[model samples]
Target: MVARVGLLLRALPLLLWGRLDAQPAERGGQELRKEAEAFLEKYGYLNEQVPKAPTSTRFSDAIRAFQWASHLPVSGVLDRATLRQMTRPRCGVTDTNSYAAWAERISDLFARHRNKMRRKKRFAKQGNKWYKQHLSYRLVNWPERLPEPAVRGAVRAAFQLWSNVSALEFWEAPATGPADIRLTFFQGDHNDGLGNAFDGPGGALAHAFLPRRGEAHFDKDERWSLSRRRGRNLFVVLAHEIGHTLGLTHSPAPRALMAPYYKRLGRDALLSWDDVLAVQSLYGKPLGGSVAVQLPGKLFTDFEAWDSHSPQGRRPETQGPKYCHSSFDAITVGSHFWEVAADGNVSEPRPLQERWVGLPPNIEAAAVSLEDGDFYFFKGGRCWRFRGPKAVWGLPQLCRAGGLPRHPDAALFFSPLRRLILFKGARYYVLARGGLQVEPYYPRSLQDWGGIPEEVSGALPRPDGSIIFFRDDRYWRLDQAKLGATTSGRWATELPWMGCWHANSGSALF
Candidate 1:
């Protein structure tokens, strides 16, 4: 209706202005006006009024009413902005008279039959075996024809909403292997051994297996979208499906997310009281921690590749490394850190303080010393040392005390040469193991060690004896022998394996 009104308004002006070339005004005007009237009647803009030849006054008034209701200007003319707004994608929820009438008839039927019912039909409910409080999920695959980044972001926001109200901790894992919850999109007839098959665009937007089943599937046929536009909102639908994955059934309340029908929800209305209570009943109350969600910029990774490539495959799983604790590795970007186990399990991300007490937030660089079995955290011009999980006494001293530069970009311990290396913009610094301070005359340029990244975000010694330096989305690999020698370095071959798969496609569960 809105489109037709806008089209007629624009077309009349064009016809009056002689802009529509060579076209007969009589035929064109009548056709356009008829289309406008039919659109209005179809969309319920006209109640019982039959489609008729409309005059300029009535048509323009109808357009004005539509514009006013749509929060547009009172002008009845179809402006470019209003025309564009009318054509965007939308949800599959149908408001046709037949559907409404059918629903009413069904309700009446059920109500009439209730008096003769022998036993009340029981509602489908979930069992008690909630997930392990802290759980992980991964996007096993993307739909063949959808925008990857939008889908990933929508999924992240959806999962984050659930984690906000429950004890659940969600993190991204490898899509190649097994995860607690595996997410994917499929077209018609996705063979899951179940007879249920996705019916193209209009029916069955998505579905999920119940808890412990650990599967979420979307119908690729639907035009899935991130925002409230023409297509189905992925966040809204996924949040509903994830409710099922977390042990929720179809809710009796129409407004609940777990309700059978899909409804558009704003960020504030993402979860309802029924949803919160249902999930909480299974998982207990949330731990009352900060909801740390990773936005677009930061990447997601796992240890699956490292475990497969290294001789110390399982050893890294049990022993502490320079960038991580014994059983888990920490991917610290900005102030948020997620603990990734060697087996690819991940904990919910938290502030630096939540993981390391007394350490200031937004740490610039960090490295665990192999000599003293302590971790050194660097931020700004100061550095703090941690013995195991406890901060050392009399700490957060100036980096100059350790012969380090202010605002170091990355740091790592080169155990073989027994030196702590730090990399900043276009330069590198090496400090020998000294109790009170680093040996003098250490900061050097990157040119000294073959061609390496001028600046890096983080670095770690791989079990294969190669050092990996991370800079933005990519990482460089350098052999151990080339630490101080001139040698051309290669890009990290395990980029995909390290969970840096898609440039903009990712979702951190927690």
Candidate 2:
């Protein structure tokens, strides 16, 4: 309706625009209601035809369908949880049959359980699959956040996940030739139509076409990540989109990889049991006729052929986002740092990297304070805390004498006690919300943190809330809630979080 209204206004220029602007839009519930309607329309929960508005009963039913698809309570009301879930980052594919499709998935699960060799169903009016067993894919581009090698490694691994269980095989397409599947990234509105255009961010992570079309598109606006448990894992998204390119539609089976939502990549097989069954039903088992091989695997390591350095290679002009050109003083007097900007009125803040060039973007010390849920940044003994858009309160506070050594080696949020931990030299300090200069028997020796040597560069928390500390190439994984290092090894190959994979694609040699 909004699109049609715009077309009408453009066609009838003589009509007065003042009358349309004269009435103020309602707020609170009315605003929520409009947003909900648009949300449902955008994702195919409701009909988008230019008919009279859906009756209240039909609209309520649409809300219930969205709730069911989004794994929320099936209450038809526009409750707070439903609204919040709608805002979460998710696959851009339309949920054309949100509720009924999920119900089919439940039935599909049971039917597949009863007969594993049942013929597969196709979802499209056009060709839903490839006739050839071998397929080649090429990356048109990649996100800047992760290294090219890492991204290709993730791609290879994602492709291998499918080939491991089915007859389908994939190989990287040569630079000069055509490929069966082409994956590309775009910022916004790259001629894919308004409905399919990549919305700046937060809506529709990526969209894909059926098998014969042989293409997948990701929103470059997304904070695409690798094996790290932050942002949207590109490997996971690539795996799911590959499913679409192979003619697999969205599966609402809660445990299936093709679910509309994302999940944290775990230590187990990336493909779920249902995912294996679905692909096998379509393409059948490998030529060897051996049992399906699903293993707890590593990221592929045959990256010697992949481009290591980007074509731009960190050039000064290409450092920042393309739209944000030139530079500014970036003035903010209070001890606060800028973050995400949802509204397009202002440019969104980039993650502080020394490579941004010509600007003071790097941070000396950074920590998320658990107490007030604000981010704290420290530079040259000066500190700033950001609450929201502004750095409220006169924060540029002096480094409090919080009983820790000067120039700590590393800082990470310790999930065990819900506090921040700082490592300096051979001692560690645990600081609570406004603690004393030092706590009793505190500034504990680094020895308590297992075999992690002093002067660790940084630390990251695992999905299970365990801490993995690293310096140079080595890492020590610790269950901080209990004992010392549970595992320690060379990080590049051993640690899954490093994005290194030992996976071998099941594709037969070409």
Candidate 3:
């Protein structure tokens, strides 16, 4: 009877009409037409000297460009969204260069800087690299009719801002062609006349892209001045914007050229060390050097060893333990359990049953010693150390106590391979011998692989002494062997388990 009912259900004709509902039809086509008309009315019938021949082709192309720029469905039709965007205020294309305009520009600058700050915070918290490599930019130069001397001066000043950085070398082969960097200057009416002056508020005051390829444009509309007041400081603003174009995001440091607001350049405040380092990071170091060698293959793997105590009736006392350990140069006082060797014969594996000191209940993470008998444990974002056997010292007691940022679900463990204390939460932090500093690891590009996950679970040191980490279900490894280079070797290793879940016993049977 059950089989017969199932057969009848499968054979029954589904009522497709039940799911269909009457809804308002889309107006994308009509919106596109309106946008075309608007563009023609503005730029089409401007001057009587120019013959007005408004063709569908022209309007169609404008609509297409608008659709593409706004990232809406590209039907070459100007829909409501496209028309709205066309009428909206243009960024970096304001009319006047007044104090109000400068204020607006300042506001925009701050907005961009704030966005970068949020991004950095996210990176620190999430351990996800959300930076993009390519940025598209159009050029706005001085009007061709501008006096040759004025054009030459503005161009020279603009170029000088970037060229002044000793570490950055500009590619100058193609005079005015497709180079990694492109430059253009606009003068007086030509800049402001098209209702697209570069000097207006929220308009182009000059913007740059990352190192690979970028373009810079100056507003010829503004009264470009060399002095501190009266008009916009050409060299100062140009230098700042160019810094952005060169991949240096705005810095919180006030004296930095990459700082949010516009400040007159001081004699000593040319190119800062931060600026030089940032630019060099993108473009190869000025002094030629060999690229660092990356590790040969993937370093991290996420696996779940079979649990000995799985079933209720037949619980096993001991589970097969995985092991990892590291060697350090020196061991300090207040350090616990040295020469930490765990499982297998890499070199040394020592069980911490005798040397292991039980920490407080909240202490989820702990690290031991290689040279001295001091054990460090982290709880509630703070560090505490157990000296010898009885004495206890909070990290704060030891000058400027620093540990990983506090999180409710924080877990701490000692990485025997790296000789560092590892903190796991939204992001991973490593506290090495050189004090509690944030780890600096190159983030892998996620564009090829959808997006990065929030929590990274499994972490293990490979046989080759490189570190391996797992995000989501995937594994990644950092080859310390190839420390100084741009690209590192990556591999996708297989693991039977779904997550990187394990506990390092830190015990070896040697």
Count of residue pairs whose backbone atoms collide, per candidate = 6, 6, 33
Q: How far out, in Å, is residue 437 in model 3?
A: 42
Which lDDT value does model 2 have at 408? Answer: 55
- For lDDT, the strongest prediction is 2
What tens-digit string does per-residue lDDT give for candidate 2 at 128-241?
778889999999899887677668767887898889899988999898999999999998887878888887657788888878788999999888765333466777788888
For candidate 3, the TM-score is: 0.27
TM-score per candidate, chains pooled = 0.35, 0.54, 0.27
Over 4 Å off, model 2: 1-27, 48-54, 98-102, 108-122, 295-510
Q: Which of the two, 1 or 3, has more lDDT?
A: 1
Query: What is candidate 3's lDDT per residue for 419-463, written digit by digit as tens?
Result: 453534334455555335545551222222222223333344445
Model 3, poorest ten-residue lDDT window?
Answer: 295-304
Ranking of all predicted structures according to TM-score, beginning with the best and ending with the worst: 2, 1, 3
Native-referenced Cα lDDT, model 1: 0.57
